[model samples]
Target chain A: NAGVTQTPKFRILKIGQSMTLQCTQDMNHNYMYWYRQDPGMGLKLIYYSVGAGITDKGEVPNGYNVSRSTTEDFPLRLELAAPSQTSVYFCASSYRAGGPDTQYFGPGTRLTVL
Target chain B: DQQVKQNSPSLSVQEGRISILNCDYTNSMFDYFLWYKKYPAEGPTFLISISSIKDKNEDGRFTVFLNKSAKHLSLHIVPSQPGDSAVYFCAATRVFDMRFGAGTRLTVKP
Candidate 1:
């Protein structure tokens, strides 16, 4: 299983430009999440989905949007990139809810908003 | 407000010594705690985890101790090796909401 996979390992975006970060998992996980980690900062949740066609905002979802079109895909959308959006974005998935079940993370996408 | 925090930004330890990383959380709702290890260009990987009912969990050379009363948890790596040198993140979750600490960079010097 590939676990979780994120596309475009790295990218540079100008202010106001929009892009989508793609994520897909073959584990058939019921939960998927998008988190951004700034230098020296912990991962902040931007969005999460419990299943197909269901999405929810997280703590840092202000400039982000997410759509879960299939059980294996959850993509994050940046409507208009900002300098603050520059960070390492990770896509993670978990088999089930609750503690003890570890979340598998993808390699991460490093984005720079210039 | 940061619900989960790793006070120490970095820690240095002699090779073959013990390295302990600490984490604290303010939310009592967190029922599960986890530790993740990450290298320079890679995503974080799950190292270990502990449930609320258990006070401690051990996985090979790594052990996790949880203090529910203090809302604190710790990860101890015995006989630390250079391979263990990386950023360690402490994470907590309640059902679906998983929160992470700022992370502690552990340097195991040879």
Candidate 2:
């Protein structure tokens, strides 16, 4: 069902540049999240949305922004990329939260900022 | 401060042996725990999960055991196969927030 899909599997950006990582889930999930994973580090949440038009910042939200314009899509924006922002980004979705439901993840997007 | 941790960075075992991966969490409020397996160039996938109320859950060759008092959980793979080799991540959830461990790389040699 293409549980979750992300565009531009790999990208390279210069400092101060901006770009959006596209994420879409066809599972009709109500919860969506964006997370980044650095080498030898656990996945850190950057942002998440409860539903369409609702979003909230997470642990590592300083350099990233997210918008949930629709239930199926949640996109992350890097306004001014920095070297520290370089990491593998993942998008995940679940039918709902606060239960035993599992989050389905999409193939990660590798980003490198110079 | 890392709330969840996988002390072992990597583990190796023969293809036919039992492989055990351990995880520990400092937060007692975490009510749910999960295990995910990830391969290179791919996102992590759900392997197994256990609710704090239960001490053990089994699915095929995979089994997850939880010890609330110790705040520790483990995943066991029996008769490991080469296909089981990958990075394993342990995750804990409290309400809406979920935290993951750094991950333990497992290699099953044939």
Candidate 3:
């Protein structure tokens, strides 16, 4: 089974442009997350959802938005992309919270904003 | 402010040697800690983890140690192999949030 799948493995956008990064999981997980990794930095949380229809902002959610319309998909939206938004984006999911549930991550999407 | 920190930016070790990576956190409320390894062009993969109540947990060749009083944790890889080369991330869980520290690059040379 495809654990977690992300589309458009790489994308380049111009300033002020908008795009969506798609992520889906077949694990039937209840928790989903979006993170961005900058060079030499840890992955920073952009947004997360506990389940479908519920979402919350994470540490670095300024330029991003997310929606969990269904349990299997959580897509990240970038509106008016900025240079600061150029980074490797990762989508992860877990069955539940706390202790070794193992958040399965997708291959990642590399986005560049000029 | 960064709640979690991985001080070493990079480390190199000969194959078959022991490789130790350290992580420190400023928050004492973290109940769970984890180590994830990431290959180039790939997302971080879960390696090992430990809980506040346990000082140590081992899985295969990887071991994670937690020192609650010091707010410190470590991942030790015994008989490190060339395949272990990657960027390693340390993460901590607090309530409903999870925080990740700057990663450490580990290279095992043959």
Candidate 4:
């Protein structure tokens, strides 16, 4: 099964340009998350969803937005891209929360804002 | 403030040697600790984990030790191989919140 899949592995955006990073998990996970990783930095959560139609902001959710319309898909939107938003984005999913279950991660999308 | 930290930015070990990667956390509420390894151009993958209730957990060549009193934990790899070269990240979770450390890059020489 494709645990998690992300579209547009790499992309370059101009200032104020908007785009969405698509993520899908065939594992039927109830919990989905969007995280960004800067060079020499740890993964920082931008947003997450408990299930379909439920979402919440995370530590670094300021420049990003997410929507969970279905259990298998969670997409992250960058409304106005900025240079600071250049980083590697990752999407992950877990069967449930607060358990021993590990969150499976996707390959990651490299974004550069010019 | 960083909740989890991996002070050493990089580590190098000779083949067949023991590699110990350290991690520390500032939160006392963290009940679960995990280690993840990532290669270039890929997302992090789970390596091993330990719960706060236990001090140590072992799996084959990898072992994780937790010290609740010091808010520290470590991952030890025995007989380290060149294939083990990668960036290792330490993570801690409490209920629904999880935090990760700035990974430590490990270079194993054959």
Best by DockQ: 1
Of 1 and 4, the candidate ahead on DockQ is 1
**lDDT for every model?**
0.93, 0.94, 0.92, 0.93
- What DockQ do you compute for every candidate structure? 0.86, 0.75, 0.73, 0.72
Task: Give the least accurate 10-residue stretch of model 4 chain A, judged by summed lDDT.
Answer: A94-103
Write the residue-wise lDDT of candidate 1 on B5-81 in tens digits.
99999999999999999999999988899999999998999999999889999989999999999999999999899
Candidate 2, A1-114: lDDT as tens digits: 888999889999999999999999999999999999999999988998999999998888998889998999999999999999999999999887745678899999999999
Tens digit of per-residue lDDT, candidate 1, span A1-114: 778899999999999999999999999898999999999899998888989998898888998889998999999999999999999999999888767888889999999999
Name model 1 segments beyond 4 Å from true.
none
TM-score of 4: 0.98
Stretch of 10 with least lDDT, candidate 1 chain A: A94-103
Docking class of 1: high
Cα displacement (angstroms), candidate 1, residue A27, comes to 1.1
Task: Tell me what TM-score chain A of model 4 achieves.
Answer: 0.98
Name every residue pair that clashes in candidate 4: none
lDDT of 4 at B18: 100
Task: Supply the global lDDT for candidate 4.
Answer: 0.93
